[model samples]
Structure formats: structure tokens, C-alpha cells
Target: MSNNNNFRLPYFLLLLILLSSSDFLPSVFAKSQNPITDSEIKKKKSECYADIDSGLWGGHCKSSSIAKENCALKCLSPACYELIYESDPLEEGEKDYIRGQEYKYCMYKLSVGESLEGVRGSFDY
Candidate 1:
């Protein structure tokens, strides 16, 4: 019995130590904060949903690909929204209209021909 306890004690201590250290923990069940407000979360979720980079780009939106990528990140903080809005091509009325209808739709449109093509050309870095 004493020998058994000695073996069990070592195993117990090891488990305690391993659990106390975060490195050995599983990441899948971890909690993460979005750093954005309830409003932004609601706004963005209403905007679009993208399969987070699952190691494959899958297929781009084929229409507003850039806009899809951009709005896909719309889950980011409010600061990110401000940064992105500055760059979207919708005029004031159109932007408002699109935002009202479905910001995701606007995001979809952004991944398109002349709009994306022009950006690709005009903003060549």
C-alpha cells in the first residue's frame, strides 16, 4: 500500500503541476474576447460571416473578394470599422443605403471588378 501511494503521489503531483502551467492546456476550449462592443458585434454579425482562415483560402468571394476579406474582419474592434469605412468606395448615400440594406452586401460588392481593379491599380504600392 505504501509503495502504491508513493507511485500515486508522484502522478498526482505531476498532474497538479501540469495543470498549474498553461502550456500543457488545450487551446480549443479557451475563452477569447472580441474587444468590440455589443453594438459592433451585432452590427458585424449582421454584416457578414466568413469561415476563419481554415489553412485554405477556400475560394474567394469571386465578386467582392477584397470587400469580403475586409468585412470578414469586421468582427474586429470598432477602431477597425472606422479604418475600413474610410476606404470603402460607396458614396455617402450609397454607403448609407448599403449599410441599411446589408453591410455584407456592400462588402460583397467591394470584392468586384472596377472597384477592386481600380484599387489594385491606383493604390499600387
Candidate 2:
């Protein structure tokens, strides 16, 4: 009985340590706040577009409205969206619109090969 009690003591101590140290534990599930910059979005969008265009994402996505949506979904993946929006709860429609706009503007910027700092501000496309 004494040996059994001794064996349980270490397990109890370990459990206590784990629970008490929760505050100091690194948050593996914590969402990081590193927002994706325009340039990074541009790069990712370009890559996804290229993949779709080249039939890498799928042949069907190459010549349909789905192509645009595929690129938007690919570039603005769940992780990317979380990084960009970071806890901002948005309606599904708003989220879709934002994703589409981001993809559109990034593609335009890529094609133009220049900063759209003032261009985007001048008019809503």
C-alpha cells in the first residue's frame, strides 16, 4: 500500500505541474496576428492563378467563373483569412466580397506592375 501511494504521488505532482504551468505554456493553437501584406497577397494570388491557368488546380477552373473564385479561395485560405482579419467576425457575404476584391486588385496590380497606393484610393473598381 505504501509503494502504491508513492507511485501515485509522482503522477499527481506531474498533473499538478502541468495544470499550474498552463499560464506559461506556449499557445500552440493561438492565432497569430501577422496580416498578409498586399505584396504577399499579390504573390500568392499570382501563384494560385498560374496554377489554375496551367490546369494545375484543375482543368475545369481554367475557363470559367469558378477560376476567379478558385483563386480567391486558394489565396485567401482559412489560415490567410484568419491572419488578415484576426478575430473580426464578418458576414459570409462580406467575407466573399472582400476576398473577391482582394484577388481582383492584386491581379490588376500584378498586371500593371506598379504600386496602387493612390490608384485604389482614387476610385472604387
What overall lDDT, based on C-alpha atoms, would model 2 receive against the true structure? 0.54
lDDT of each: 0.45, 0.54
lDDT of 2 by residue, 23-122 (tens): 5454444333354567866677677777777777666556566545544554555443333333443333344555446445544554445454543223
Error of 2 at 11 (Å): 3.7
Q: How many backbone clashes does candidate 1 have?
A: 3
Off by more than 4 A, model 2: 1-5, 22-31, 64-70, 78-125
Per-residue accuracy of model 1 over 3-102 as CA lDDT, tens digit each: 9998899899998988877766644344333333447556665455534343232445323545455445454323334434546633322434323334
| Clashing residue pairs, backbone N/CA/C < 3 A, model 2 | none
| Candidate 1 to native Cα RMSD, angstroms | 15.5
